[model samples]
Target: MIYFSLQTPSIPTLEETQAVVQEVHQDLQQLKPNAILETIRSWTPGLLSFSYRLLYAAIIIIIGNRIAFYLRRFLKRTFDRMGMDLGLSKFLISLANAIAYAIVIFMALEKIGIPSTSIIALLGSATLAIGLSLQESLGNFAGGILILVMRPFGIHDYIVSEGVEGKVLNIGLVYTTLLTVDNRRITIPNGTLSNAVITNVTAQEKRRIDLTIGISYSSDLKKAKAILERIYREDPQILQDEPITVYVDQLADSSVILGSRGWAATEDYWAARWRIIEKTKLEFDDAGIEIPYNQMDVNIFQKTIDK
Candidate 1:
């Protein structure tokens, strides 16, 4: 390898450093006189300008909020016009307003130069978590929606479901409230109700009232049937289109069971049933129709003693 000569650059002298510093100071002084802050102050308007800008921004926000409210109101009105359930319509309106407010807030955030993208991501994550946690509630809500849409029963309709019989008082998002004939309040979960068998007693305009009358085995069957038929004929509430049925259904140990069925308006079902029972008792008493009772006999055998 051939040897080469190396040289180092010489450092600046003290006097040369002082000259550089002086030049930098002079430049800063020259730039400071024409700074942007002083120029902005010279061009600034009075307080009225600031107030106007603030008022304009406020008006924009107010308009946006009011628009959201009106839109929600319109949606609610439309649902009401369609004869939808009050609970469902109110829930939907609240949901719509919430969504509209969220959108308005996002737009306002953008106006203020806040990063809304991250907020949207956070909201999406939160919504997903909440939905997962409320899965069963959502399912029940859907079931309620189906109930209202399908209209299996209406208010004050007598319905039997989940081994309970009652009148439907109101239908809600998660459950259906009922008033039983015994003056009891029952709440059935929509999820269970939707899946179970539902018997709507008041779906039809008329229903059949079934009554069984038991008489003494020795009584005349023809006479008992005739008495029942006469009572049904006298009751004006009893429907004529569907004729009353009366026949000997079964022979019990103590009496002959007579089955009687008659049609009546659904609204008058209970009254009709009571009337039939009362009339049956009165007629049977007048005709000396003995309604038999169950009787049991016991025989005892004693051992004979011979002395």
Candidate 2:
């Protein structure tokens, strides 16, 4: 007689495997109540641990945010009290706020057991990319800051930069706005303006008017100079300390150049310049001085037909 074994095989046949799985599933379903209790007994402590950590991280973040906010406000107030430029103060405050928040974020992550070194590295890479992409913007920002600190020009100050001559209307973070004499509004990038030669016409309390007049070489230089000097002296608006200079500047191909220079208040610069030009022209006409122009004598070199 053969004896049948009661123990199950470790690797069952296909049908046996399916049947055993179905039976085990049914048994597990029957034990669900006890199984859930056992699972809860095991997971209660871990869940509580996770919850406490999350709560701690949240509290840290809240405190950090508050601290950062207060610090930014304090810095802004201090700068304002010190009479710093409003635009610059606001920019500094924004930058400080961003930095403070970034530090707080990193600290919060670190408190939660996240390795901050990787996060910092990742942020550094991102910052580098952003910086490279915004190089021109960064340059403009730097230029604006330099202008604000150095005070190369001020509002309503006349200046010539990057081929634009106008009165400064506003200095922004990325550009400077100007109102041209012809009433045109122009915007110039601060980076380009900072790099080029800046002629600040209103930096000084007094500015000199530069007037040039061309006269025929045959005209009497002494007479022209005397006439120019008299016009300057007769003008009550001209400053007394600043001498009116009238001298021959150069001998061009067609004419003699007379340079007239006189100092006046910066505000009166344009008025003085216009007045000098008008008066000089009138005086020259009255004195019968010839204002010469460029003349050209062209001789055609032609081949003559052989006779």
Candidate 3:
């Protein structure tokens, strides 16, 4: 059998390294600027090609911008024809223009020779990051969109939601503003309002007024009901088409509670309600009907034995 020896190369000492560096420095004197000139010469042919691409991209961007404007106008007209809210229509138009411009920008970028796939990836990542950070705001924004589109309630409509009762003043992107009966303004997040139990009082043409009154047990139930019904009939604002309902709803410890329901035009609901409340007391007084109150009798036993 023959044995083969494998020898390792020895490392260069300091002197050998210095000598190599000196030799490289001497060779640098003979080198020219040919490498830079060659690079510029090689790129000269592509310059015209790149310039043309840039010019084409510019033209595309300009034409796309004009198209975006035209689309905005067309969308506005379409939305108006479809009976969309005016403010919402404007917002949608602006959004459409933004999307159009973004698409044009990406196309232009691709024409300029940048890879569109990489740009889209970068945009997607950025959008994901922004979306995570703005989840709550985005939810409110989405809720606003739903409200605008569905129109659950409109401006000046009286609504009750989340234990707050008020007239809607403005419906904005992130929040809804209301004016309370006392004329104080309050704003609620659209997200919360969208999920809440919304009671729109004036959504219908006619409104119902409910009033409750109490009288002594001795008073005639039939007469009391008749008086309430008459009051509802007398009110001009109260809609006569719908039937008025009055009944002895409950016999409480203090009095017989009569519940009255009357229908009125939406605009006259408050007037009818106030009139009924005021006239009930006057009618009962004239009829000598007593409105009962809580009373307790304390009988003191004679303390003669103790005395």
Candidate 4:
């Protein structure tokens, strides 16, 4: 037979237990301030580095903006000296300014710890998305470039396209502004404008004025032609170097149509035409020439009572 021996564990008194707890609490209280100081010391360098970076970023932005402004001013002066087309010069200046600002922004971002490569990748993605979504706008931008290169029309040119007639106010990247004769502003997409039939009224140095005058068949054709030729010769705006032609154009049922053609300076075209028409009317009346009009004669007979 085997036997085992055991002993009961000793239990501490209540006063002893309370004294131990008090001792531990006092030890923790003594270490708390040291722990707090250690934590602050560990974070100090990182915090200071972040603060310096933020301040540097701010300075970069400020300096970069100033440089961009000066650069834009310089470009404007250079373009003025070169006598560049207004539309093309404006477009190029704006494009340069945008590029400068983009560079400045990327520099600021890099100072704040953002990588330029990452930014470029993000921009690439964004540009692809935008290009897909704004295809028409991109087309308009391309059209603007074409307009600047080909030079179909220029600033202040009076043009008629897509049924809209106006003076070109500005040609931007995506839209071309027009100021109508009535002082209304119209904005047209450059893409549409580039594709349409553009009639530049003031493109030439001189324009022709063609007028058709109708007189009674009984009127003397020779006299009408002679009067028209004389009027063309007397008009100061009509260019004497150009050929003037007046002839009988058509013979209708009740009237003979006389056609007159004369050349005038582009700027004087409207005034010259108006003056010629007014003088022709006055002179024709004075010469006893009858301008025919349609007239219907009504006859009522005894047949109406029979009906």
Question: Per-prediction RMSD in angstroms?
Answer: 9.6, 9.2, 11.9, 7.9
lDDT tens digits by residue: candidate 4, 1-307: 9999898888999999999999999999989988999999999999999999999999998999999899989989998998777767888889898999899889988999999889899999999999999998999999988887678888888899978999999988689999998999999999999999999988999999999989998888889889889999999999999999998899888899999999999989989999999999998998888899999999977654554
What TM-score number comes out for model 4? 0.64
Per candidate, the number of residue pairs that clash is 0, 0, 0, 0
Pairs of colliding residues, candidate 3: none
TM-score of 1: 0.67
lDDT agreement with native, every candidate: 0.87, 0.87, 0.90, 0.91
- Superposed by TM-score, candidate 2 places the C-alpha of residue 268 at a distance from the truth, in angstroms, of 2.1
- Candidate 4 ranges with C-alpha deviation above 4 Å: 1-84, 90-122, 304-307
The order of the candidates by lDDT, greatest first, is 4, 3, 1, 2
Ranked candidates, highest TM-score first: 3, 2, 1, 4
Winning candidate number (lDDT): 4
Candidate 2 accuracy as lDDT: 0.87
Candidate 2's residue-wise lDDT over 1-307, tens digit each? 9999899668778998899999999999889988899999999998888778778889988998899889988998799788777888888889898888888788777777788899999989998999999999999989998887677888888998767899999999889999999999999888888778999988898987778888998999899989888888877668978888888899898888988888888888778878878888888898999898767899999898998
Among these predictions, the greatest TM-score belongs to: 3
Which of the two candidates, 1 or 4, achieves a greater TM-score against the reference? 1
Whole-model lDDT, candidate 3? Answer: 0.90
User: Model 2 compared with the native: what TM-score?
Assistant: 0.67
